[model samples]
Target: MAEENGAAQPQVKMQVLAQFIRDLSFENNVALKGLTGTEMQPEVQVGVNLDAKARSQPNTFEVNAKFKVTSVNKVNGDTLFLCELDYGGIFLIEGVPQEQLHPFLLIECPRLMFPYIRRIISDVTHDGGFPPLNIDNVDFLALYRQEIARRQAAAQAVAN
Candidate 1:
């Protein structure tokens, strides 16, 4: 008997729609404090949430990767708007193979979101009365590979 993919039948194509910021809010330096030490202990808290919207046609979807960042003092309760940004992208991906789509979603989609995310972070930090926060470029490709490897290792270990 043929393997039943059922509702999970793999689609040969995929695509992204216009990934724009649906909503965003930023709070700058809430509290100010004098520095005790020249070395600042910057603590960054990053939260990421994933969302997907299906298009009218099958295999087409828009993905949003939202990132929220809050920086605070390690010793004191001082707050800093290091960065907070919601970035999204609409990708036109179709007629592509399934194996290829994984990387596209994980890497390519995030890549598209990066610029907007960076901008929001920089502006928010600057407006908060601090130097702009320059976030480094992210390598989604490498990350995707690493994640895949880790998952495979875990599965192998479980089987053994």
Candidate 2:
């Protein structure tokens, strides 16, 4: 709560206006290469990137979460599959202070969109001739802090 002239100010408001996939691609290397193995130990790695921009409408913004998943056979180190997804959401946000808006958009908006993104990846992997891949929950706050630290380090290096 924020105090304004001795009274508490209104709480922040946020709403999801819409969600959609901007781009998606899946490649099944096992099928492509016809790799046959009795023991298939798969190792998967996931990468996430986020972007946000204000919309023309007031108090509205678009946030995009880009996910890339790659699976390789642990035993032979051969590529198994690859999936790339760009998911986005349109949000209606209000009452948030300007200084805090960037973090809110990058952290909160992506957190809200993660579950759907996870499901899509799982389904894509399953349908692509592999076991379902359930991704671990992301800690957006930690990611944001790490990015801030990296930026500071880069700036310091440039200054030096």
Candidate 3:
């Protein structure tokens, strides 16, 4: 909140200060053999993980989201290609309550950064000589809930 002309005001703000590719790897396993178009659909596996931690700077955090994709010939299980990407963004948040900080950092920040990461994955796969691999939308809320449950279960096991 700031005073404007001696009047009090309220303000809320959140912003992405920067975004970058922390790491990326693309493997065209059969490039030497060459990728000829195939009639049969290839099987694809994708995995994503997200993490966030406080930065040295005040009210700032670094968020990392990793996406890994692997494709193989369905019939023979031959390697087609593999891609791994680590995408990160820096966020600046203000006026948020202490109790809400964890959820804000984990869920909201990644939600804001996912589109760019998804686009990078699609572009890299397309440039690697296959059709654009479109990633499905992630349910961050569900993932957070699942992680919380897993931790609780692990704690119970350890106590018993």
Best by lDDT: 2
lDDT tens digits by residue: candidate 2, 37-129:
636788889888888999999999999999999988898898899999999999999989899999999999999999999999999889988
Candidates in order, TM-scores: namely 0.64, 0.93, 0.84
User: Scored by CA lDDT, what does every candidate get?
Assistant: 0.67, 0.92, 0.85
User: Which sections of candidate 1 miss by over 4 Å?
Assistant: 1-17, 29-54, 74-79, 149-160
In angstroms, give how far residue 126 of model 2 lies from its true place. 1.0
lDDT of 3 by residue, 1-160 (tens): 2475786543547999999999999998768556566544588898878888889999998989888899888877877899999999999988777778887877888899889988998999899887898888888888778888998999999999
Alpha-carbon RMSD of each model: 7.3, 1.6, 4.4
Clashing pairs in 1: 13-95, 14-93, 15-93, 16-90, 16-91, 17-90, 17-91, 19-89, 19-90
* Residue 71 in model 3: lDDT: 89
C-alpha root-mean-square deviation, candidate 2: 1.6
- Worst lDDT 10-window in candidate 1: 1-10
Writing each residue's lDDT as its tens digit, candidate 1 over 42-85 gives 77777665554546766666777767777787767576553546
Question: Global lDDT for candidate 1?
Answer: 0.67
- At residue 135, give the lDDT of candidate 3: 84
